[model samples]
Target: MKHLLRKTTAWIAGAVMAGGLMLPALAEADTIKIALAETPSDELAAFFVALERAKANGLDYEWTAFSDEELAIQAVLSGQMDIGFGTPYAAMQRSRAPIRIIFQLSKLKFFPVTTTKYEELEDLDGEPILLHSRGGGTDSIANVIEERLGIEFGERSYVPGSSNRVAALLGGQADATIIDLSNTNKLMRSPEADRFNVLEMFEVEASDEALFANLDWIQNNEEDVQIFVDALLSTYRDMHEDPTIIRRETNPDGPIGQLPEQILGELDGFYGDAVDAGLYSKDGGGRVAANADLEWYSAAGQLEGDPSDLNIEDFWYLAPLDNAMN
Candidate 1:
């Protein structure tokens, strides 16, 4: 099967080299459009650092910060963007538009937080839950929880961020929600920590955020994609070598560098924690991560199929990351 997957990649590469794929409206020479799911902050410093590196290598790009992950996916689907930050597994399966995840930005390092009323995941049986968005990472977490714990949840509400969900929990507006690692740490350290419980969850190394685009578009703009992937791979490796490098390489005149002093102060710590948690795989999540995603999103109810039966090449065009490594 692994050998067949390689052959599939070879076929795709051959086709791309032959210019067999149709060119997208965003032509090969046009600036790449990147859809950011949220406003820039500490969470995106490393990505911005990579962008700076890509820029140094002559990759032209512009980024739009969408309201949420779903909108980001929609932007790419609508051809309003060239690439986006998200896991569009559901859209990929349902649309069949040859959308392929190129690189994984972060892993599913989220924690399920609840009030003292729930002691475990199973205890939340049929209980209302607050989440990040309709089809985003938190929603998939909820789906996986229901499947794994054999407990169906009641109402599922959408708030945008983990910090906002934390607010809802504090204001008595919500009792449970899933949040990222940094926010989870903050919540546990809060004075209201006694009021909540961070449920013990099974380890999930699936992608939480990734870069994806229509395969035709990627093939059309192979050079830019290669530069971008190379820059990202270097940044992830450098972060593992020393997380402080993100803070150091942050472009002082760019988006991440223009943040408030407090956020800037925490950038080093944020990347440090993220690297320590293995939030990014050094290979940038090609074949292994694609297979893991199939297993994960399948169990999470986002994709329909026995995981092993899924054609990984359909959901992931690993040629870019593969070439970047070589």
Candidate 2:
């Protein structure tokens, strides 16, 4: 099950190693291989939905899952993976990975969970904190804390996964950590609820995850790329138009329905919980890129110009998504 969520090895060797998302005439003919992160999160589900739809539209494809976003970007840069699920906007701004965010994947809407000893972000200024990794989503949240509340965390540690980070907090090893919807929901319902406090802090703006590809590869496989992007646009429309479509599409026997038993058991309840928490959406149209432009500009210290004066198209090439949707 963990193997399924982190499918990077097989696909990287077979697809990305060969060349981009396209197959040469001498290469084995199966499907275009795409890179994905291993977990069965909403982003993965959306990609799976697009895969199914793309298949129906005659666009056959395979998938490879990486352990984390950092590796996913490396895969695309090295030409070991075609299009991975998501990459942080900061990565593009900071790294030499010749990649572009082709489509917006998802945003990190976090809930701050702290040990009961503290009540707010201000309360966490002088404390030890935990996160997924040095440059992961949770770490990005910590940066927001320094930027907004004018507080610096006393000590910092990386735990590599949000679930593990959450465990660190639960065992009284750390004061606080920013976690995703799934873990956040689980923690709130746990009997140890009395041990922590979830704070409603200022939202962090980021293009949390995005579909990225080797720009050179995408330049050559225009036709296949259009088909792939089209399917995603369709799924995007459905996902935001009605979040419940997720539950309906995720059959116990289907790709999403076939999640690890533990994660599967929580699907329906999680989906409902996510919708109520403003986690999932059905109106995800052009908002992701727009948000990404503003968010990245600010995070990169480039938001000085009026957001209205900024030309977002300079940062995004929506032709793939546009061609796909049309």
Candidate 3:
């Protein structure tokens, strides 16, 4: 009887030990939450690719859809999100929270979409315009327009998404708006296509969406951060080589795939549209480093010193991207 009791107790003790060992794994398995503005534009394709690679690296992730990039950055700054996507310039210079852009996502290639009344940037001097968000990518482009053409938009309105801004224009709620390739393509296919004209705009010195995290949070989660960055570098290489890889690897049941059926079916169309719009590159070697230098010059006012005098090293740490790329 004593021997049998001893054996049973030993089995229970072993089971408890095994369960204890799994506790940390279960805790570590908690989803790493990220946030980004709505719309799966080509600029953000690398992230979807990273998510797929992240799973294989034992990192689980969930994403939150924000109305705009500024809000997404706010989420990360507030600690409500583990990571979020946005241009590194504003967050680095404007935000109160300490955050860093660990990965370079892409560059902005925005064109001005205006009514027939406005043929050029000069025509917009006294006109109202809609943008994706205030103090965001579109706003930055607007600033560039004012600088280049010496014309300032009369009234600036903040509409959150490219689709939302496009709809507002189509519905006659706004006269003109800036938009991305995805919505730009959709607008051309709509009945109001003839109502607006896309103006030829120069490339602005702005980096597109990038992965950002609260500095402290990132330091504590170093391993996970390395894993995420590695996946991003790998995915970026593949996306540059063949943009179609994203569509093929998209989880039909996952968020990227769970996009409205229409959008899903038109994935290739969007990719092609973006490429035609000069929003993406086929070379896959995105101008990550050079663009950062240009961005510094453009955002000179935001920095304390002249861009020519400022050290790029103070703002960017390419070690992460370099490590991942290697």
Give candidate 2 misplaced runs (Cα > 4 Å). 1-30, 41-43, 94-98, 251-255, 260-262, 280-288, 291-297, 300-311, 324-326
Error of 3 at 25 (Å): 20
TM values, all candidates: 0.90, 0.78, 0.81
lDDT of 3 by residue, 29-109 (tens): 245778876656444555777777877887766777887887887777656677787765645656654566676565576
CA shift of 66, model 3, Å: 2.4
Candidate 1 local Cα displacement, residue 77, angstroms: 1.2
In terms of TM-score, the best-performing candidate is 1
- Residues 129-237, candidate 1, lDDT per residue (tens digit)? 9998888888998999898878999999899888899999999999989999988887888899999999999898899999999998899889989999999999999
Output the better candidate (1/3) by TM-score: 1
Estimate every model's Cα lDDT from 0 to 1: 0.86, 0.64, 0.65
Which scores greater on lDDT, model 1 or model 2?
1
lDDT of 2 at 63: 67
lDDT, residue 72, model 2: 69
Question: What TM-score does candidate 1 get on C-alpha atoms?
Answer: 0.90
- Which scores higher on TM-score, 2 or 3? 3
Error of 1 at 265 (Å): 1.1
lDDT, candidate 2, at 11: 25
